[model samples]
Target: MDIKQRNQNAIDLTFQNVTVTVQTKQGKKLLLQDVSGICKSSQITAILGSSGAGKTTLLNVLTNRIQNSKKVQVNGKIQANSTEINFRKFSEFGAYVMQDDVLLETMTVRECLQFAANLKVQGDQHEKDKVVQETLKILKLERCQNTLIGGQFVKKGISGGERKRTSIGFELVTNPSVIILDEPTSGLDSFTAYLLISELKRYAINKEKTVVFTIHSPSSDIWQLFDRVMLLIEGQFIYQGKGNQSILNYFSNQGFNCPRLQNPADYLMSIMHQNNKNAQNYPIYFQKYDSLLKPYVEKEIEQGEKFEILSYKFETSFVYQIQQIAKRSLNNVKRNPILFRARIIQAIIMGLIVGLIYFKSEGRSQVVFFKLIVQILIYLSKDGSNHPTSIRDMNDRNGLLFFVCINQLMMSLKPCSVSFPSMRKVFIREDNSKLYSPYAYFFGRLIIEIIPQIISPILYGLIQFYMVGLNDRTVGNVFFYFLCLILNSLLGLSLGYIGGSIFSDVKTAVFMSPLIFVPNALFGGFFKNRKNLASWIRWIEYLFPIKYSFNAIAANEYENTHFIPSPTELLNLEFSKWECVYILLGFIIGLLTISCFCLVCNRKRQQ
Candidate 1:
């Protein structure tokens, strides 16, 4: 197969005097000032700068990742040949390897490559496997093909250098015309960094792919691999052109002569500090160097303006993208057995604990039932924290009596509630690929997560309901209680998912989840009489799944009791078991609906 024939050409990127500015609280800040450069097919361009030199920001401007900011202003054209490519269009032409390696750590090396291949190409299983194998070989990761990449939980994969290579391989599988990588050599030793740059250079020359990446202080070996270099200083383009020899000659012409024993990388670092008060002598050196390069920079700009656009065509299918995403998701899940095992263990532990707490009750079991209700309410509302002093004494007394009594509750809720933020990492990876529609992902999660939660809660309810020594209630009542527990668990899962989605970090999410649960638990009729609650608070009860679930469970438990009719005497004062079932189902459906709506809104905002 002719790879070059299969690939798209006519891909030339141009930035004409592109300036990016942002307004900060302190004042206006310039991220990129009148910077201009070109990236084209068949060449590798290295953007060289020190830390905070705005190289990444320039890339963001070229890719259209930056949004409108009061402090941000752009005044230049970024075009692909004749067609002006905005951020979105630029995104379509290339894949960006961000500074941070964001990958599914649970996936193995082979699985990760296959996942990318599936997303980037369409073919039979055999063809896809071949692509994955070839990519792994290209990265020299064949030896660790089956190794799981380290995550927070699992640390048993390739080294940092290999991980970076894996990231590049993912983008390469897509066959993007231009690959933009940010600090690709980051975290790698000098030898590995040299090898990585050499590999990239060979790939660009041999395969005719455009390689654009940023590097901070490259070693001598790595520097020799670049065909072109664009040097940046304080958000300005200090230099842009071909060859390390030319760069050295340009500096020497300005009388900034290099010492025989001095490293070029170290010399450049000193030049970058010319503006600092401590580096007074370097200012004179930089002035001479800057004057010598001014003419060359002007000539490049003139040549850039005269360049014409090239024409090319690319072949891709939407269906192919979808199939790739699905395969990747499935393979990733299979490769990470620890996650599956963790889910199972959590289900079993929760089931045993809840089951032991709520065992069955005998005749006139209202007191025992009330105590069980309070415990459930407390557990749902609080995050394993000590109950307040007001409630602590009552809890201790209840424990001593072993009999149920009405308890007054008073506790200071924390500013934030416990939440699982790490789930966001999973959601983000899935969300970015457009793997499944928002609804599909939501439903998939519902199916996978709801089952374990339902099973555990039901097992607990069943064990507790019978062991507490209830009267001769039908087996149907036992099932009804289990249904209530299942609905409650669904409610919790929905809340957790929503919380995870809204917050970018786990710490913030953890703090927020309980705050959300507190109001739901309060209005669920666990603490106070639903009828006697304040009118406004009573309105909140209608919106809470726990309100209905608690009511359904309580009504089914007290079905045999009699109650007075309302003053109008027009409606039944007591709820039937059938009514309880309907209410529980309604609550579950309502929460699920809201969860789906939240997800849809979030997806739109992201897009």
Candidate 2:
């Protein structure tokens, strides 16, 4: 399509006097200095620069991805179709593909695009599916459509080129008015890079969309595909004009002719890189661009017409977002069955081990003690009965109860802490893309986590409860014991979520977890009596979920016992079993609320 025949969605992206500086100890280090350019519809613009030359910085600045802050300052006029706009307004018409391909590794190429469409495409199921298939075809991902986008730690699937194209397809499925990418061909082979840029060019022309990306050293074949080019040295633009020989001609005009058979792109890069010898040349080239080349861009910007700007909006409903996120999570769980199966198997094996080691020791001890009492009574009269011990010794019963509480808690905690932080990048990427809100993602993850939290506790309780021989085997007691374990597991998961959400690094989250959890475990009433703790510090027991859980299970085991010294009084638990249950529920809710707050705050900080 030609410029005039461009679709209504077509819009030119232009930025002038754009300067970005970061506050360092040295003060006001320039990242981009007065960069100016325009990316017109139906054309592809490539920003060329060496490492740390501010090509990506200029892209982020023009796209308004960089904001003024205590450490950073940005000054610029970014216009869409010549109308100045803010970031939020610009988001309505622009989509940015990050340099790193932050994709859900568990998903296949088709499924990934489908998931994006469900959250980003505005239509019914049929329309969303159609968009996904079209995107697959456009990005040439159909051959690997069903192959999982695996990672280094997981099973490897697609090649580097395919993965890169998949990342671009994520933004392309939306058919945005202006598509901007950072280092789109950074990790690809020469032929693959050529294919990627060629597809981008065809897509830009066919769809009448403005396309811009940053590249370091593109192959000569790849360089020929650019309709426009902007080269930067340090933070200033040295050239801003047409690509191909036009760039060579401009440099040759400045007394630097291309060597025969040598790549012109490489030739220009060598000139820019020769800092010690040509340190003075950067200013000259920039000055030439300002005096000779910039006025034409300025005239084009002045004469450009305005197009209608659309308001920023999400494509799907909040409920739909939660559904799609949950569905994808469930699918991931199905594909990666090792983790899920390991959790259940761990619970079963640990339950067997704990049960066998302490197998009915409490029951057997009470049975022996009572039989002696019966023999003594028989010397005076007569008595006998066949029954396993039912809560006579406070130490054995209380010990089992405490172990169960801590067991459930740790089992739930470690996995959530390690796994959640690992997915933080993917979550942040999707969140920033506006695919879904933090609340939706949090709830979706909660749904997946809750299933195991419930199932594992049930299996653990069923295996260990009767085998260890607690107070009474009544249905109420059994259900209450199971309930406490479940709540404790959920509590542990909540704390895990908090740690994972607060820290972006998995190792850091896991390392710091013990510092937070071990202190609270000391207040669980088994390690030290809550009443014996200092008056000032005794209140910590009330804040700890494990304390309430341990107390509740202990009270359940000791309630109808015929023990001499009351275990509940000895343990210094002021709350009843039901009261502790209620408190644990409150703790679970409160901890999860903190997790949500931390997650939301982290996202804001990233922005």
* Candidate lDDT (C-alpha), each: 0.59, 0.80
Q: TM-scores of the models, in the given order?
A: 0.79, 0.93
Score candidate 2 by TM-score against the native: 0.93
Clashing pairs in 2: 363-389
Candidate 2 lDDT over 349-427, as tens digits, reads 8788777766767334222222433433443211211122444445766777788888888888888877668888888
lDDT of model number 2: 0.80
Clashes of each: 18, 1
The best candidate by TM-score is: 2
Candidate 1 Cα deviation (angstroms), residue 94: 0.6
In model 2, which range of ten residues has the least summed lDDT?
Answer: 379-388
